[model samples]
Target: MKNRTAVIDLGTNTFNLIIAEKNEGALNELVHLEEGVKLGEGGINKGNIQEAAFLRGMQMMKHFSGLLKKYEVSNYKAIATSAIRNAKNGPDFIKQVKVQTGIVIESINGQKEAEYIYGGVKSSGALSDKTSLILDIGGGSVECILCNHSELFWKESFEIGAARLMDIFHKEDPIPSEKITELNRYLEEKLEPLFEQCKIFKPHNLIGSAGAFDTFVEMIETEKGNDVDLRELKTYLFDSIAFAEITDWLCTSSHEQRINRKSIIPLRVDMIVTASILTGFIIEKLGVKEIGMSAYSMKEGILSKLIR
Candidate 1:
């Protein structure tokens, strides 16, 4: 019989559940599920998980627990990131989850989160002999990693995630130009160390792992009238020119307009603009010539470890 495993990533904005079986030293995926609970909805920047967010998280976990049991996963790991790690009631929430759903939750720090993201991206065949930068933008944190195919050169997780940025800078439906400038300036200050490292490593390839990049790729594919199968795609080359155009459209569109778009999901409609701005900023600052998107990220990273 195959050994079944379930890995749950309780992210700030979305909770993801990935179930797989170990077979011949490899992982065969059984199920992949995502729930947008918005765990950081009203309290991420304030360093607390709000009451509504807490209830939403608990409900999601209960649902995920049911799925895990249905799959009969022999081994399971539930890991929480950013919002939970920084929240004041995070520990209490974990205790409650264990008591209520019989699922132990482990809250990992930003550095470990970055490592897992790197592992996931590496498994997707994104790494190469030449240096490359891996960027994973989550709801509460953005992980940046510099590496080649073999080893990691540098990695860091910034608190400036899309949800956090949205909360701070997206007061207007269509964010004002002045607000964007402020946001960029804030990012430049926080990412000074990353920029310095970029100068030293000179990594020209920027690989985006999961989250907003997935939506970006979908949007791009739709615009081109292409019938690209996203599941079969391990890596996608992101056209910078097209990315710039998308960013402009996102910044000018209202909430209603964004919701009407097929490419933009309901969960990401509000925060996608901030994500786009951040993506464009990094491309310009790093002088990145090539950009690729990796569908695999933290959950896959966990699976890789278990199978190995």
Candidate 2:
């Protein structure tokens, strides 16, 4: 039997599992699964994972452990980011996972998380000599990396994620324009480091890693009636004009309208509006010439290291 490895990403909003077998020095993907645990649901922004979210995360981890056993995985790594890392009960949760499931969960810092995400996107071969700004928006935090094809220039992780933003600024169902303005101001304040870095490095293109970008691509494809295979796509070029249109709709649409859309997943319905706003804010702030999406993210980044 070949070596099979499993990688579990315990994200703030979703827990993702990827099983792959090493074949002739490369990783051949065998399984991919995602469970929306919403670990940041109740009070993650307040530095705590609420009781319900904690229980949900535990259940999801147990389920992922079962999948790892079913695949007879020889090596496995589980990582917790953002919500778990920032929460006061984070270490307790990690201990419970190890004691109950015998799976040790590593809680990584934002800077390290950005590094792994960069590794994943770099593996996609979408990058070039020109500096590209890579963005991975998770539930509790957003990882930003500036890099060319060869080396990393600068990287930072912001805690102003969709979940945090939703909790703070999304009191209204369809967020009020004033609230949007406030959110923009908040982003500008929090993202000053990124802005300063952008001034120096001057990354030309925005490369969005998984999560929200996936939904954006799906929504755009549904609207255009295009059948692009996302799994096979190394990188997707997103039209900035079309993205602006989508963001506008998301910001102005009600809960009923958003949830009814086939392209919006149930788990993402509440948070996508904030996500769209954040993406739009970044694009405008950076003055990016183009946008691209990479389906690969943290899991792939881990797999690349493991296989090597």
Q: Can you give the lDDT of residue 198 in candidate 2?
A: 92
- TM per candidate comes to 0.97, 0.97
Q: List the residue pairs that clash in candidate 2.
A: none
Q: 16, model 1: CA deviation in Å? A: 0.3
| C-alpha positional error of residue 74 in candidate 2 after TM-score superposition, expressed in Å | 0.9
For model 2, the superposed segments whose C-alpha errors exceed 4 Å read none
* Cα RMSD, each candidate: 1.3, 1.2
In candidate 1 the C-alpha lDDT for residue 211 amounts to 90
Location of the lowest summed lDDT over 10 successive residues in candidate 2: 225-234
Model 1: per-residue lDDT, tens digit, 1-308?
Answer: 23798899999999999999877865678988888999999998999999999999999999999988888888888999999999999999999999999999999999999999989999899889999989899999999999987999999999999999999999998899999999999999989989999999999699999899888898889899876655579779888789778878998889999999888889999999999889889889998889999988998898788767
Pairs with backbone N, CA or C atoms under 3 Å apart (clashes), candidate 1: none
Q: Global CA lDDT of candidate 1, please?
A: 0.90
- Provide the lDDT at 7 for model 1: 93
Model 2: per-residue lDDT, tens digit, 85-116?
89999999999999989999999999999999
